[model samples]
Target: MITMSLYSEKDLDIELLEEKIIEPVNKTNESKHIVFIHGFASNSSCWELFVEKNKNHYIHLINLPGHGSKEYKPYHLIFKFIIDLIKKYIISIYQNYGPIILVGHSYGGAISATVTHELKEINENIIEKTILLAPYSKYSILKVIDKIKLFQIKNSDDFMELQKMIFVNAEKTVYELEKYLYKKLSLEFFKKNSKNLKWVILGMSLPSTFYKIDKAFKTIGSSFYFLFGEKDKLIDNQKTIQRSTINNIQPYFSIYEDKGHAFFAEDKDRFFNEIENIINL
Candidate 1:
């Protein structure tokens, strides 16, 4: 059986990719940890607002390889990325502290689910709680956003427009963030992570979600808590709701009626409340 204890080289194989990984460690003790993973095209800084309130726990804000840095090789399939990320951060940190509370936004939330699934796989008490903000829980065929609205993004302006379309009512701060990140977008940004595009496409062609592997939520009731915005066009809450109903999984799924794809960044009070609720649970 795989051990939950981390920082042991014998358990996880991450040495070959050490140089490529970027883990930002901040001030904290060794008892508790909160690992934050950002979504597609975004960096670890996605935890901007939540970080301020939760300064007590140790945090691992990582820049996913190929998203904001050129240090690591690009990942194509989401599963491979999740595996490596767990090996690099989750496992190692579990050794330092114990089980951690994981918070992931957007695609990061999907990645977070995969990590929880992994920790569950080993029956390892490595994840005490999980908060997924607007996560894409399953593998879906490329939707209109991925194929059209997302693929049609030609420049920075187009990217911002896409945000407006998906998030009908975003706050000024979220808009500012969109504009800022858009400015950094370039042709290379799209091509950079294309290596794993093949696997992503394959995932879309087939049934991929949690069924691709033994589901973690199956064993652990309510360990995985989900938060979705009602208007999120990119990741439909309906599918999540449907999936939840069909499977009878998890403890909570808070679908904010007024929010959209950018719910985590746009709504501060609600986002923190959901996370705080999970922490308290």
Candidate 2:
């Protein structure tokens, strides 16, 4: 069973939403540590399959700020706050176990890239590798535009309805849609940290700001891998892979033909297999 713990640092408090930490029953040691980061509006539960499949390895699952059991407060600092929080956690983990291989899904991918960049700047050897699953580069601009457009609309009901149209998959029922949105938004967190949420949503959406991240990727020396669902509706998977290629980073890329935005959740076997292959290689 996955272990659970609560962690706090001054004003910030987070639930250690971990999964499967026991040593293997067979007594073989796994060399690599894997940390999974879920996408926007989602929590650590998204990585249940990977955790189940890779029970032998040291696996860590985390919920981002303003989500899960973490305290929700407006953090005007945005990415800086996230980076600092990750740095603290990484350091704490390293004290016990060594560096880890980072894996992130969607928005989590973006955070993974950012964390790798920061780690590379501080200590190139700390982050062994990073995997960006269906990451967003240029597409973040679309979200920024959507935010602006959303803020301008008059009625809250209309805005909420439109949000549903944009984010929720068309085939899902209302209950599923609500669950999906609630998981991501953690509406209570939003209510508590409304201003910070606004700044982060708007700030991250900007193309110019995202470009800085691209520049950071260029300088970071860690090996990178890109995996995406071929049918992802939110991002141009091919374009993202191609863009990563231009960096001369030589990332391993995989496109799952039958999957979409939530590929990890939709096709657990394939996702876990890809991860195992990456780690073993």
Candidate 3:
């Protein structure tokens, strides 16, 4: 019943989100809403494939402040600003649509999980499912050297190197998109906002931050599921699960043996099939 335009670049004056990241779409009668949150340094457009694949369902793609076309304001530096903004958006969506599914990738996954926990405290059962893809919660499994390389990108070569860390293999469209993505990342726009973006990431990775996420995953039960790539360079499936065990949490998760951190981007068809099965289940 509610949908955000998937084709618009126009800035939105709404306090929830700064701009319209997608173009307007034909309204559907479906009551189910699928909300997607993209990863760090990524925009709502990352979910364009998912949107196109589920054109018939109501969908909302959230663009975090400073990501997409959003301007980086002083308040955007705080992690709570993002978590609260998305929680407010989700509540508003539930008021219109009956219930919704929340999906987040990487950093977005951490935010989504925390927000879901906050919602649960208020006794809101509007989120039918929460799917996290290679979520960046707690300290990363990446080695110190590789992690440093990922955070500090000085050139296109560095950017491509980061891409390699994200994807299992950079063949097909992934290869083509990297050039264009690097160009954008190298622009003055990205340069200006880089500090704020990095701050947001650091804020999200705080031990206090992920403690809440772990609690959320534990309490939310099976409705909250984690899907990770066993071969992921950024997040090690075994280490992540082992950490969860240490926290006395048993997570509902799956590990794709041959995939990497951005497995969905690598093999979308198979990814969507997995998504379809999760939603159907």
TM-score of 2: 0.73
Candidate that would win on TM-score? 3
lDDT of 1 by residue, 1-281 (tens): 87452233443344322222223344534335777877655566657676656644566676555455444432423455445555556777778667888877766776677678776667558888887776655532344335443534457666566566456564465455654453455344655544434444444334445453225334434777778877777776666555544566546778778777767766767787767667766
* Minimal lDDT window, size 10, model 3: 5-14
Question: How accurate locally, in lDDT, is each candidate?
Answer: 0.59, 0.63, 0.68
Q: Residues 16-94, candidate 3, lDDT per residue (tens digit)?
A: 3643323236554643577888877777767766666664456677668767565566556456667766777788778
My TM-score estimates for the predictions, one after another, are 0.73, 0.73, 0.80
- The TM-score, computed over Cα atoms with residue i paired to residue i, of candidate 1 is 0.73
Worst 10 residues of 2 by lDDT: 11-20
Question: Which regions of candidate 2 are displaced past 4 Å?
Answer: 1-27, 143-199, 206-211, 220-222
- Write one digit per residue (lDDT tens) for candidate 2, span 200-251: 5655666645765676555544388888876676666766666666656676
List the candidate 1 regions with Cα displacement exceeding 4 Å: 1-31, 71-78, 139-154, 170-210, 213-220, 245-250
Q: Candidate 3 at residue 278, lDDT?
A: 82
Q: Return the clash pairs for model 3, or none.
A: 5-22, 5-23, 5-24, 6-22, 6-23, 7-22, 7-23, 8-22, 8-23
lDDT (Cα, 0-100) at 87 in candidate 1: 52
What local lDDT score does residue 235 receive in model 1, on the 0 to 100 scale? 74
